[model samples]
Target: MKKIMFTGGGSAGHVTANLALIPYFRQENWSIHYIGSVSGIERKLIEELPDVRYWPISTGKLRRYLDWNNVKDPFKVVGGLLQAYRIIRKEKPNVVFSKGGFVSVPVVIGAWLNRVPVLIHESDMTPGLANRIALPFASGICTTFPETTKSTTPGKSRYIGPVIRDELLQGKAERGRELCGFRRDKPVLLIMGGSLGARRINEAIRKQLSPLTSRFQIVHLCGKGGVETKLESNNYRQFEYVNDELPHLLASADMVISRAGSNSIFEFLALRKPMLLIPLTKGQSRGDQILNAESFRKLGYAEVLPEEQLTPDSLLERTMDLYGNRERYKETMKAFDPGNGIKQIRDWITTIMK
Candidate 1:
């Protein structure tokens, strides 16, 4: 049987792109295997899939800052590479497709050692530290942004666009309204803080919830451990996380307040949702999100409210502004092509195998 292995994980964003591509591989009857850390979110998401085998490997953080762990992480990476090499040797997959993360570096190197072709996907405007280190070993790197290609060796990177989960596009607005138990009198504003939740966003939204509630019905996906059950209102619904209903919630939303992650931004583009993006500032991240938000703003796909400028008043003002300018964004998003790369990615995998 035809076979392929996939590896990536640190956040849900890393694993989700791989999840979007899995159904096509199954339809073609390719055997699938995945390598990830045992405790990572990827292991939690991948282990239960029916046909795909999940293998756990040890991995270390690729921190950009110096810490005491920095002294010891190199040894952990070496150990992970050894474990990945053994796993690849036994599985003997025809090719390896990597969604970039620290866990993926070992897997990419191990696949190269086995003489298996490797393809990598990068979701930021510029490659992350993990992808940068894995670049030389990759056969071809697929990117969500064309600007990312300039940072890599010519011809090594291709703009394949973003991989969006099929379920997201199939959301039903009626179902979302029913689940949230709200009438359609006011427009819905969905606030997403990613998997780990954004403490600052959660606090700011709540501080201004009274005014926001007057203007719009609010649906908040506040991430795990970030919920306020005490304060309830007819116009507001709070969820720790929504799995099956996320699509419905998204479909019902007229506007979104979210972190500027590329996967989420591209999905919003496909859904034609007007958005006010709040990016993690350079202090908190390597500034990829700052770049992602800027690109979206530049293309008129969304509006940006930098993290430092994020006060309760500013958040509400920007959201209102985005909603007021909603039609322009909708028209622009229609023209914006965040290409669906599933077919192209699978085609690359097939061609490399042959």
Candidate 2:
């Protein structure tokens, strides 16, 4: 049988594309393996798949700010590098595919050291730190944004657009309504702060819940530990995180308020849901989300509210504006061409393997 190895982790954004692609490899009867940090979310997600083998290795966080851990992290990355090298040599996969993240850096280098071809996927408008370091070692790079090619090696980059999970397109609005105990009289507004949740976003949403719910039924996906049990209303629902039910929830939403992670914004785009984007501040992130939000806004797909200026009042105003202009946003989104990302990347992998 053919074989393939995948690596990426730290956040859901990093691993979700890999999740979307894994089943295709399975159908082709490839022996699939995943390498990620031992305690990262990737381990839990990949382990849930029965056929794919998971391998854990030491990994250090690639942080932009100074922390005590920064002093010790280089050692961890070196340790991960050695472990990944051994795994790549033994497994001898046809090629390694990476969705860029801190954990992926070592695996990419390991594959290069083992004389194996590696392909990388960069989900942001500009490459993240991990992907920047891995660029020279990769045989090819797949980008979700057309503009990202300018930042990559001249001949190695291909713009494949965003890869969306097929199941997301198969959701039923009525089923979502039933799951959320929502009535159809009001349009549903979905609020997502990302996998870890956005504290400021959550707090602002809660403070304006009464006004928000008066106009639209609300589904709030609070990150883990972000939910408030004492706060409940007939028109409002809160979830810490969702998996199987996400498709339905998304299907029911007429609009979305979310952080501007590239993977998530693209999913929202694919669903044609008008959005109000609140990107993470430069202090909090490397400013990728800010760029992601601006691109969407420029394309008329969403409105942006910078995190620095975020307040309950501003959020309410922006959301109301998004609702008022929903049709226009949807029309622009309809004109967008979300290329066949999965097919293109799969074809690339097959060609490289040969």
Model 1, CA-based lDDT: 0.91
169: Cα error in model 2, Å:
0.7
lDDT of 2 by residue, 8-125 (tens): 9999999999999999999999999999999998898899997999999999999988799999999999999999999999999999999989999999999999989999999999
Looking at candidate 2, what is the lDDT of residue 87?
Answer: 100
- The residue pairs in collision within model 2 are none
Best model number under lDDT: 2
Supply every candidate's count of residue pairs whose N, Cα or C atoms clash at under 3 angstroms: 0, 0
Query: Per-prediction RMSD in angstroms?
Result: 1.2, 0.9
Q: Rate the local accuracy (lDDT) of all candidates.
A: 0.91, 0.94
How does residue 345 of candidate 2 score in lDDT?
Answer: 96
Instruction: Name the TM-score of candidate 2.
Output: 0.98
lDDT of 1 by residue, 181-210 (tens): 978878999999887889999999999998
Q: Which ten residues in a row are the worst by lDDT in model 1? A: 345-354
Which candidate achieves the best TM-score against the true structure? 2
For model 2 the local lDDT of residue 229 reads 82
